[model samples]
Target: MFETSLSGLLTGRVALVTGAAGALGESICRALARAGAEVVGVDLVEGGACDFVADVATAEGNRLMVAEALRRHGRLDVLVLNAGVQFVAPIPEFPEEQWDRLMGVMVKGPFLAMKAAWAELTGRPASRVLITSSVSGMVAEPFKAAYVSAKHAVNGLTKVAALEGAPHGLTVNAVAPGWMSTPMVERQLPEQMALRGLTREQVLELLLDRQPVKRLIGTDEVAALFAFLASDLSSAVTGVCLPADLGTLAS
Candidate 1:
């Protein structure tokens, strides 16, 4: 419903977004493109918006994607580490493999991607590295130990990168969003219902209860925030995780 245009904000800039096949990642790619940035979308599987199909969890994949983006665009200005995966289970019953997989995709992926893009990003006058963190990064949630841990680590990585990038005119930051109306959240509903022994409606109510907004967040809402952070307007803002949690953090 937000109709404002962000055109011309990132003219001549090239942005690379991971998890480009997912709802949030695809939306971010579109948003950056709308802002006049040439976007290179990377994902494990091919999607309509994905320009490169690569697993973000591997160092080789990360390096390849960054190299491909630079090859095509000739310069990289924004690196958005938005790849993520979710597994829901009580900590006692959680599978160690799942935990490792989540960490690899979320935490390790971002770190490797950032490392791979560092030289190209720092070579520019003003570049940005944005990580997709979660409200779980700041707070805890049940049946999501891996997700929570990965997000927390991502926040820490963002701060460290911010400090190191400051002297090079590169900014690093993160966005922590609450529950959004996306396929990922939809998939969680069945797991949450079974875990809590509640109906789908009840599970929905439980999720909304944490936020005062009484509704799920829109992907575009979060993508717009990323666009702002990727632009010159947010040059002074770095080393912080901005929340788009619909008052969930406030309450």
Candidate 2:
């Protein structure tokens, strides 16, 4: 249902994407590049797609990455906060450290990244900040207290940034995706199975039970949405968390 050619849509623009080593992040980097943007991939580790390695959960790391991008690219036009970490467990059973780590990566990371890139992004011809949220941000899901809470906070942050950026020609938005066929989701299956005392197939069934479409989402599908939001076509679309959930929220 997505258009194929976004070529030249973002020509001459520079984009910085966090979590560039991961599958979804890599896909986003590719999509943005295909759209003609000069994509700079950032991660905590090095990868083929990753250009810089830095922990985005800290203020200093955010500052360093932004500075490096500006140093290399000379300008910053797109910022994609796609870095994420998932820890699943009941609220009481969740580890304190894991909770802190999850919040740091998903919540604080985006906030700090945006803050660091604020000046560079604002007053530009067309600057965009796109966050990677999740369906958990829209609805509650069990065994994901930290993840759900972090995404909810991110959704709120997206709106606040959008409001502050509107007058400056800077648009801030987020993409909330549903179950995707990524290593992250694959890792969660075993945890869900053990927690719910279900088989692997049963756990998969349970994950898709709420959605009208009985399938996993593709990274490219979500990336396409991001590409659109990052382009001039979506200039009027800000402060919104668009879902790429395969009708999960619609149901």
Candidate 3:
């Protein structure tokens, strides 16, 4: 169990979070649980129910994730779409396989999950779909074509889902975080250094320099946004792309 602000913001609700094994996923799950919602954590890894263990990149996997949510909780109140990957390669050198792989997970994966959960999400009196996009989607960066493309698609999906979900008493929104200190970012450290031949600290410093706030985002902070949107507080707010990017985009 996770402890939160005791807002009781999501009391009696049930939430399903994909990519739950990851740092952001775990934080979101725990936060939802703490907010008084029973959470079903889904991932491609173990620890999450075996029934929920399916690749987000596959059709079968997306179906199973929704099925598991129904099995664990009769109704789904919130769907947190957070599963994604990052690959850094120059456009000229970018592997076709890598581009396809990233797009499949970051774009197609979330779309399938939303499609599978449509009935359940729409069935609920109040439902929400919160997708984790990135600043890369909003702004262009070097050597991140695949990642940027997928994120842009996610934003587009969020807008469409918002329009579709509104009639069903559901809201769809996205959070675009800049540089959160998560394992996702860490995973690219060595490759980043090798590519640029810069130290880890230097890489981080360069990233921070671009941020107007000059700080990395926190997982809990991102979770807090999800909690607010998933709850009644943001009922009227939908189809919005919120930047949790430490003012990076503002600059």
Candidate 4:
């Protein structure tokens, strides 16, 4: 991160990013790649959108993911747990199965990934784990019971990892982003419309209302923050949840 430019900032480090099929994940992969890291992308689709494909939500799949990553690159310098799923519904009506799947993907998934990558990560002098938390992790919202809860768990996991990895010189952190202008966020508009009986524009406004900047976050913007966290420049910034929420946290 101390480099004069983004290019070659990562130099020889190798990064593994999950949920590479999504826009944000792909952008993150590209960003780290541009910064000179050999990025391996993991996704659910078989040979789909990333360098590697696997179901990150399962323990077996995560074990295999780390295996393949190490086989390919021989070292795991950075691990980005960005895979996620969303199911929005009022608490009273929220399906138990949906809650299970959401937590599986967002919480257990990262736990497994970290567990599998621990040896490889600690083998090196410096390593990083970057988890994707959300603004919902800090502030709760209606119809987002599962997401908020899982993100909150992610924050807890990040802090715990930071403590355990401190002696090993490994840093763990979370990037808590607000609503974004990505397809994943767009897909939720209809759900909101149906749940709240609001028009698409109205739903968008409501989602953006908390952010004084009044604009959806860009994937590239989040990627920049990830790059910083992945680099040595942020070595002193472990066990923290940094927000990329366009002034939302201010309000």
- Cα RMSD (Å) per model? 0.9, 1.2, 2.1, 1.9
Mind sharing the TM-score for model 3?
0.94
Candidate 3 worst ten-residue window by lDDT: 45-54
Q: Between 1 and 3, whose lDDT is larger?
A: 1
**Residue pairs with backbone overlap in model 3:** none
- Candidate 3 per-residue lDDT, tens place, 76-111, comes to 899988887889988999999999999998899989
Stretches of candidate 1 above 4 Å error?
1-3
Q: Please give the distance, in angstroms, between residue 21's alpha carbon in candidate 2 and its true position after superposition.
A: 0.6
The candidate scoring highest on TM-score is: 1
**TM-scores for all candidates?**
0.98, 0.98, 0.94, 0.96
lDDT of 4 at 70: 85
* Predicted candidate 1 versus true structure: per-residue lDDT over 44-113, tens digit per residue: 9998578898989999999999999989989899999999999999999999999999999999999999
TM-score of 2: 0.98
Tens digits of per-residue lDDT for model 2, 42-63: 9999984798999999999999
lDDT of each structure?
A: 0.94, 0.94, 0.86, 0.90
| Residue range with the least summed lDDT across 10 consecutive positions in model 2 | 1-10
Q: Worst 10-residue stretch by lDDT in candidate 4?
A: 1-10
